[model samples]
Target: MHSKELLKGTLQMIILKLLADEGKMYGYEITQKVKELSDGQMVLTEGALYPTLHKLEAEGLLITEKVSMGKRIRKYYRLTETGQSSVLKKVDEFTDFISMMSRVLQIKPAL
Candidate 1:
């Protein structure tokens, strides 16, 4: 698994990108998706995930819907119009950062 220190900086971007791609997802689903995508290299505990979800919702970047499943309620989150635009910018910025880091570290792409 990646260090928490490393994952912390990128968590929001990861969440936003996942929501952007998957439409809407609940907390658990998000966690599982991240694990799946990373091939078990990254795991998001509830401690880290919920606060970020709440922050995104508070920022007007995400909106939620609640649905009843039997006796329980599940909240699903999706991006707002603002979030849709923001994710595009975030993805571009991160991509540029990765390229910059590779160049600085003298890492070459695999052929």
Candidate 2:
């Protein structure tokens, strides 16, 4: 797995992009989907997951609907209009970020 701190910085964008692409997902489902996509290179914990979800919901970027499964309620989250806008911006930002980091690190060409 990658470092927790590094993943923390990108997790929100990652989640947003995932939801933008996949529509609705619950917390554990989101985490597992990311893990699956990344081939287990990164893992998200509930300790870190819920707060981000709540923060995005608070920021008007996500909307949640609760569904009852047997005795439990599951909250599914989906991107709002704001989240869809943010996803495009974040995708550009991350693309630029990776490009800048690659340049600075001289990743492809040794000095």
Candidate 3:
């Protein structure tokens, strides 16, 4: 599994991108998708995910719909237009960050 700190840093962008690609999705679905795509190396915890989802909705980045699924109502999240527009930018920013870190953390043998 990946570090919580590293995952925390990119959670919002990841969710946004996922929703952009997959349309409306419930919380459990989102978690499963992330695990599958990352080969089970990354996960979205409730402690981490719900708060961010709420925050994004509050900020107008996401909107939700409640649909009755069998015996219960499920809240499905999809990206707002603004959220879609920003996902690519966030991805580029993350790539740049990883590149910078890679350069700084390059391994070398001591003489």
Question: Judged by TM-score, which candidate is best?
Answer: 1
Local accuracy of candidate 1 as per-residue lDDT tens digits, 1-111: 778998998999999999999999999999999999999989999999999999999999999999999999999999999999999899899999999999999999999
Better of 2 and 3 by TM-score: 2
TM-score of 1: 0.97
RMSD of 1: 0.7
Q: RMSD for each model, in Å, please? A: 0.7, 2.2, 3.5
**Model 1, C-alpha of 32: deviation from truth (Å):** 0.4
**Which pairs, if any, clash in model 3?**
none
Best lDDT among the predictions, by candidate number: 1
Candidate 2, 86-106: lDDT as tens digits: 999999999999999999988
Candidate ordering by lDDT (highest first): 1, 2, 3
Model 3 / residue 66 / CA error / Å: 0.4
Model 2, residue pairs in steric clash: none
Better candidate number, 1 or 2, judged by lDDT: 1
Candidate 1 lDDT for residue 77: 100
State the C-alpha lDDT per candidate: 0.96, 0.94, 0.92
Q: Which model is ahead, 1 or 2, in terms of TM-score?
A: 1
Candidate 3 residues lying further than 4 Å off, grouped into runs, are: 107-111
